[model samples]
Target: MLLAIDLQSETPIYTQISEAVIEGIAKGQLQKGEALPSVRTLAVDLGVNLHTVNKAYQLLKQGGYVQINRKQGVIIEPNAFPIADEAFKQRLWDRLKPAVAEGVCRGVKREEMMILLDEIYRDLNKM
Candidate 1:
């Protein structure tokens, strides 16, 4: 997968790496069971430290997006969609609350927000 990073961004490099992987999956650039590059190789390619790549991989694994195998390296996980468990819902709410609040504060209409969400879903589904 092709991953890019913005060194000047406030977000951490590892977070950016993990988000790129997630976007790849959403865009169908990555498929289930697809093998990812070794952490060291990815770090070298991205001109970052090994630990940064490793941390990104670990986050992906924790989020159920990838799996790490001692002999096989890393691969995308099957059925990696987010579950609707309470914990997942809570976390989703926690993450969205700020953005939604900001939208409200900006006087964004419900229809506009819904349209934006639909556009994003359509974009992802186009993969």
Candidate 2:
């Protein structure tokens, strides 16, 4: 997977790594059952710490986006994708509310935000 990390950004490196993998999956660049680089390998490739990559992988595993195996290493979830349950919905809301609030505070209109969201959704789904 290709992860674009901005070291200077305020966002944490591990968060950026996990987000990139999630985006890759959404964009169909990473497929189900596909193996990801090992923690050490990815750390070397990205010139980040091994712990950073491992933290990202752990987050993905917790989110049900990937699975780690001793023999197989790390691979995309091979079975069903995670269902959008109530817990997920609440989590989504919690994560998005702050961003939406920031946009609102910046005087971004509802329509404008919707348009931007639609564009991003379409772009991610374009395979």
Candidate 3:
């Protein structure tokens, strides 16, 4: 899988790296059980410090999107995607509330927001 980072972005490099991997998985570019590039190799390829790559991998692990093993390196989680629990729903709402509120403040109609959400859902499913 190919990963790209924007050196000039306000987001941290580690966050960009982890998000890229997550997007790759969602886009079906990286399959479950696939091994990611080694930390040192990826750092060299991205012209970043090895610690940055390692931090990204750690984030992926904490997010349950990947697993790291001494012998196997980093691999995508093999289990099915997690179902949203109550806690997860709460967290989702917490994240979405601000964006939805911003839309409301901008005079975005509910129907327009629904259509936009539907479009995003469809695009993700298409991948």
Please, what is the whole-model Cα lDDT of each candidate in the order they appear?
Answer: 0.91, 0.96, 0.90
User: In candidate 1, which residue pairs clash?
Assistant: none
Check candidate 3 and list the clashing pairs: none
Cα error, candidate 3, residue 27 (Å): 1.9
- Whose TM-score is higher: candidate 1's or candidate 2's? 2
Clash number for each model: 0, 0, 0
What digit string (tens of lDDT, one per residue) describes model 2 on residues 17-92?
Answer: 9999999999999999999999999999999999999999999999999999999999999997899999999999
lDDT per residue as tens, model 1, 1-127: 6899999999999999998998888889999999999999999899999999999999999999998999989999965566779998899799888988999999999899899889988888785
Candidate 1 clash figure, as a count:
0
Residue 47's lDDT in candidate 1: 97
By lDDT: ranked, best first: 2, 1, 3
Candidate that beats the other on TM-score, 1 or 3, i.e. the better one? 1
RMSD of 3: 1.8
User: What is candidate 3's local distance difference test score?
Assistant: 0.90
By summed lDDT, the worst window of 10 consecutive residues in model 1 runs over 75-84
